[model samples]
Target: MRGVVMYAPGDVRVEDVEEPTILAPTDAIIALSATCICGSDLWPYRGADDVDEPFHMGHEYVGIVEEIGDAVRTIEPGQFVVGSFFASDNTCEICRAGYQTSCVNREVLGTTGRAQAQRMRVPLADGTLVATPGIPSDDLVPSLLAASDVLGTGWFGAVAAEAGPGKTVAVVGDGAVGLMAILAAKEPGAERIIAMSRHGSRQRLAREFGATDVVEERGAAGVARIKELTGGLGAHSVVEAVGTQESTMQAIASTRPGGHVGYVGVLHGVELRGDDVFMTHVHLHGGPAPVRRFLPELIDLIWTRKINPGRVFDLELPIDRAAEGYRAMDERTAIKVLLRP
Candidate 1:
């Protein structure tokens, strides 16, 4: 089998690797038919994470079940499934509370490097993978794959920020997750959606996703635009999708006092000032998205073609062109890259 491997910063190669097998009674093996490059993958690729030599790459995947462990009864071979980036047993205490990302026995998919390979192991099979209602047509594959990560992350961001009826929402970044956050806020009946985007393409997509306004400003000016649109009150909810200090600041400033800020960017060395956050008195919550909890709902939307998240995937290439996909995203030429194995 072949998988994407990162040997050094800016060095991504698709090379032959061992195929995964069911390692536990609750594990399942999936043959990936589709996968994609995530913005988070760029962190290590850009030398931010100090990735060791020859690390396994990629987490977002949608595939077919080739085999299941002895204990896996609900999902059988040949079933098409979409899973969270992190595998969690749905019956755990935290999972029961709808926080599957913190499941006691969680296993992050693809951390073991074999994920980019043709076949990968999925632990806690019964809880992690959600089978689509039926075999989907080929066109729906990309959207279903998005549901595995970006869409789920965006939905979680909106929920964390309390985006709902009669409230104005602001999104801090224009990446795929941020675009989906716009859609997610609209789903919950948010009255007004403001997206901070300088890129014309992203801004257009944001509007299509239900953003009522697009702020082309950055930094302080951008925050002011959001506040100005909301009549100096800022937005009731803000979604932060970029992990940098500036993006976080923009998200906080664009939100009003007593509003909520949901941040899901993989935090780096940046810190939030305690005084500012305390004085703002706004709610703050977000982490690695509990994608498992939203899996079923998102799948239904995709299956029915209610939301066409596949639009976020601007580039498609064979798995062998994985490096090009990474480069396009790194250069900001592509919003998201979809790869087929």
Candidate 2:
């Protein structure tokens, strides 16, 4: 088996790795069909987060089940499935409340091992893996893979912000997740969607995904643009897809007094001042998205071709050329990179 590993910042390699096997009765092993690099993975890749030792990379995945442990009842071999980054028992109270990422028995896959491989073990198989109607055509693989993480995360961001009919939504950041948020806002009938991005390419895609307007400003200027578009009331909901202090505040300040801010960015070194938020009268919500909760619905949408979230992948590379993919993303030459395992 081959998998991607980062030995140090700017040092990523695809090399022979140990094959995975089911260690728990609730586990299943899947032959990954596709995987991809996530923006969060860049934290350590850029040396922002420490990389003291060799680290396994990748979390987003879609594949065919190869084997399942005895207790894995719902998921079986031959089923093409999409999985979340978090392996959860789905039966827990937290999961039942639609926050499977906080399940009592949860395992973070990227930290636990690697999904950027030909095959990998998935714990709590029945709970975390959602099978499609049938084995999908090759053309649908990438979109199905997107549902595993980015799409689900972006959908969660929109839901947390309460984006729906009659709501004006503003999304901060032009990353994959942010673009997906634009698609999500459109699906739910948001009256207006403002995509705040400085990149022309991302802005074009954002509009295609249903952004009614584009704001290429930053900080206070960005907030003002959003306010101006909404007649000085700001947007009804704002989705912050960049985990930075500036982006977070921009989201908060761009929302109307009673609006919501759903932040889905993996917080890097973000901090907030109590005084700054106390008078905002905005509802703040979001964290690691409970992707499992939305997997089933998202899978259906993908299977039906209602959305094409996989278009986020502007570049595709073989797993062996993962290092190049990382460099392309780091240098802003690619919006998102998809890896064929």
Candidate 3:
């Protein structure tokens, strides 16, 4: 088996590794059909985060169930499934409360520097993986994979921001998550979706997704544009998909008083001023998206073709060339890169 490993910043490789096996009765092994690189993975790749030597990379994936442990009954071998990045028991107190990301038995895949291999073990199979109604057509694989993370993260961001009918929504970032945030806003019937974008392709996709307006400016200027478009009132909800001080400020500044701001960007040396947020009276929320909770609904949407998120992938590469995929994203040559194992 070959999996992606990053020895250090700017040093990623695909090499042979031992295949994972079901370690528990509830475990399952998946043969990855497709996997993709996430923006958050770039933080360490760019030397922004302190990643110790030799760690497995990648969290978003979709695949076939190659084997299942004895305790797993709901998911069986040969079933196509989409899994969330965080593994949860689905029976824990937190899982019952719908915070599956925080389940006491939760585990984050790939951070151990051991994910992205040809096959990987999934813990708590029944609770973490959602099977499509049947073996989906080949074209649907990427969208199904999107449900595993980006789509779910975007959905959580919109929900956290309180996007709904008659509300003005603003998204801070032009990445896949941010673009999907625009789509998420539409499902909730948001009257207006304003995406803060500087890239032409992302801005166009933002509009296609449901962005009523695209603000090319950054910082205060962008915030002002949002307010201007909303009749002196900022957006009622804002989704912060970029985890940085500037993006956080943009999210808060572009949102109306008492509005909610959902931030899901992996925080990287970013801090928010309590006094500022308090004075603004904005409701702030967000963390790792509770992807496990939305798996069923999102899977249905993908299966039905109500939304096609596969357009996010502008480049594709073999798993062996995973480093090029990472570099393409880091250099902004591709919006998102899909890797075939």
Which of the predicted structures, 1 or 2, would earn the higher lDDT when compared with the native? Answer: 2
By summed lDDT, the worst window of 10 consecutive residues in model 1 runs over 109-118
- Predicted model with the maximum TM-score: 2
Candidate 1 global TM-score? 0.98
* Model 3 spans with C-alpha error above 4 angstroms: 113-115
lDDT of 3 by residue, 12-117 (tens): 9999877888899999999999988988888888988777768887788788999999999899899999898899999989999888999999887745525466
- Tens-digit lDDT track of model 2 for 1-341: 89999999999999998999889999999999999999888888899989998978889999999999999999989999999999899998999999999899999885425998899999999999999999999889888988988998899999999999999999999999999999999998999999999999999999999999999999999988888999999999999999999999999999999999999998778889999899999999999999999988898888899998989999999999999999999998998899999
Candidates in order have lDDT scores of: 0.89, 0.92, 0.88
Of 2 and 3, which scores higher on lDDT? 2
Preferred candidate (TM-score higher): 1 or 2: 2
Candidate 1 lDDT at 88 equals: 89
lDDT of 3 at 306: 91
TM-score (C-alpha, index-matched) for candidate 3: 0.97
Candidate 1 achieves a global lDDT of 0.89
